[model samples]
Target: MVLRTARVGLRLTRGQRNRCFGLLRAAGDVWACILEINSWRRRRGEPPVAGYQQLCRLLTESGPGTFAELDTAGARSVLRRYSDAWFCAAARRKAGHTDVRFPRRRRALMPIRWYHGTFALDGRRLRLPTAAGCPPLWVRLDRLAPYPCETIRSVTLLFDAGRLWIDITAELPVATYPAGQQPDPDRIAGVDLGIIHPYAVSTLDGAGLLVSGRAIRAEHRMHLADTKNRRKAVAGRAPKPGQRGSRRWRKTRRRARLVEARHRRRIRQAQHEAATSVIDWAVKQRVGTLSVGDPRGVLGLPAGRRHNLRLRQWQIGRSLAILHDKAALAGIRVHLVDERGTSSTCPNCRTRITKPAGRTMRCRTCLFAGHRDLAAAFTIATRTPGGVITTPAGMPAGVVTHRRAGRHLPGAGRSRRDPRRPAAPGSVGRLRPAPPPSVGSRSSIPPGMDEDPQHTTGKPGER
Candidate 1:
């Protein structure tokens, strides 16, 4: 079995919202107290306490009601968060990363978590454990849980993008297929990751699949332009370095944050759709293994400011995670291979060629021409780990299946970004239907206009 998480929003009344925020602040206080203890230890030249058991003992000694409306389980989760962070930082520093620092910053709010047995789920309602002698805190979910209640392992309550959400994690079993329909381990496919096309899959049989991300790209571009305009419009109202922001400025910042969150949600949904398409195609073709190109190694290199922004918005790491997680659930093996020269190398002759600036790549040595991304996928299959020379004579893109992502995003219509492309079905801001022409010819005038039977300026039988 593997673990998965889905975030579901909460449906709360005004009082519930305040209570939830209070719990978060309590968690933050718990975190701050831990940090304060470590600070005193540092000042006295003594070792800081970070062990989970020791911290729990310390919390018990402080007595109950210390964190109002926060139970032992909830407060312990915060302690666990701190201890984990400290260990993670220590490990990093021990591994030659001296820049890594232990947890020291104070936060106004922190997420609270409840284990499987600590929380109760009833359809769309959730009962969260609170401090002793306090009424049980029950909250409603905006939507039903995606996973079976029995399989749910934990729930984390956190505020993000100006909204409250609960992350529900569950353990699920891998998919199983009928006999003869199960994917063959020998049948492998290669995946090429790119910004324009999020996923390009090529099999050894010359079949391919390309999931276009043009809509996602346009969404990012439009959002960027919109954000720039908004920022410029409010530049005069922005607070100085030492001055506190006015009420209007605070509202503007909140609006910006909401917009940013919405943009993130749209992009995330589109990426998931793209990944799902890849997995569905692989399953249809009985593909057992996928060799995905790892491009993160090159992300740290300076590629100019414009390209850097483009790369950052590309969100390559999230794409990889989405694909990997879905592939795991589908019982498909994935290998991440170094993708340094795959895009420029000739698939037919195995010779290095200059990377083309366009979608098509031409190899001078072999006179080969094909979709650049597909060629890279084919070459990536040849370099899959745990296998030697698995790729056959590389073929140009053929019998390819095409799909698109981000159809539900705002401004997905043809006019918002590209005039040539039609709007995606079910997209936001779809154009209105064309209206009847106002101007009419003499032979086809409206009935109310110049309607004379004997000397008619319009056609006869106007009805």
Candidate 2:
């Protein structure tokens, strides 16, 4: 539940940009040189090296280098950054991976200038040391805090769209659960993840909620196609390994690079929005227990183009990650139950159906007809180890209600009419409250009438 907020980029003059780049390049060069030196050593019969301060000094003692000299703080920070990178690389290698690839000086590579403890924060500016025998550099801010400045560890300067920007890394704070919430034990929710529908939630109450993610997938594909075209155009042009910068070559390279970055960012934002909406709905429903089918296995199968397309639309893993994380913060329990035969098996009857084309799903044995996603959701919702319903346990607390339906005499003679007698204390043995008069629906209640505090049926304001 930790939240990260960023302030818009601050406009920097050309001089300021150069200074920032100077500090950034100094740091990048330190890391790059260290990596190269380590590679060379590994090639020879020499041990791998560690720590870059001594190496930094040796590289810039009295040479015609980009950086005139190295300061103690900058030198130390560079070493620490590379050390962290080395640890990460080691972890990846330990997981049966091969050699590590050091980061290159790409357009959007890390541009960290200030260290965690070395840089001092003025009222509206940050100051850090750099080489090149220049004065200490300062990053001026328009306001004291455009975002939660306290959370930010450091800001890295970056060049994007011919404009300078800063990428701020911050320690996001966790959000607390709201008041008067309890976990619902009796109710379970099944989610059918898809690209077109995004989320198809079938609650114990038999209500289906469809949250469309069409725009999200469409935007992502659009950007992806644009990127592909740009890459193709770049590939068509020929260039030598050490050719000097040409107008067309640089222009195409820059365009391709920008498209790549923008497209990734667009996809990220869409995912955040889609996941947020799904999580919000789950929270509102007070869903104590949630089960999302693992579609990744199916997606990995060698299928036809259309099948693969549908599978791609189902970002089940990503959506599930969002649910799990949000539910953890909210204290709701989430389970990754076996999704095998969830859609094929009927919830009402244990009969399995063969794959049917199009969107409708009809249980051959039970004759239960419903939307395919809704049917899958219902099947998922009905599954549990024991038939007995209990309160859900996990992240995000909520309340639960039990209900049952059975035949009753139309006009049975009774000695005395008791209001509480109809409810039967334990299970809500009856239908839901009839639709409001305005809706012009039947007075008969729908099956599984227990209300969900977190999510409600046909609630106009529900988002």
Please report the candidate that would top TM-score against the real structure: 1
lDDT of 1 by residue, 1-463 (tens): 8899999999999999899999999999999999999999999999999999989999999899999999999999999999899999999999999998888999989999999899999999999899999998899999999999999999999999999999999999999999999777788888999988899888877678777788888788878888999999999999999999899999999999999999899899999999998999899899999999899987899999989998999898899999999999999989998777989998888888999987777889988877788888888878767546554575643566666677687655432322124456665445433334443223353332221212222111111
User: How large an RMSD does model 1 have?
Assistant: 11.2
The top-ranked prediction according to lDDT is: 1
| RMSD, every candidate, angstroms | 11.2, 14.0
What are the lDDT figures for the candidates, one per model? 0.83, 0.56
TM-score of each: 0.88, 0.65
Q: Rate residue 309 of model 1 by lDDT.
A: 91
Candidate 2 regions with alpha-carbon error over 4 angstroms: 1-8, 47-109, 113-134, 140-147, 158-164, 182-188, 224-245, 288-290, 304-337, 378-463
TM-score of 2: 0.65
Clash count list over all predictions: 0, 21
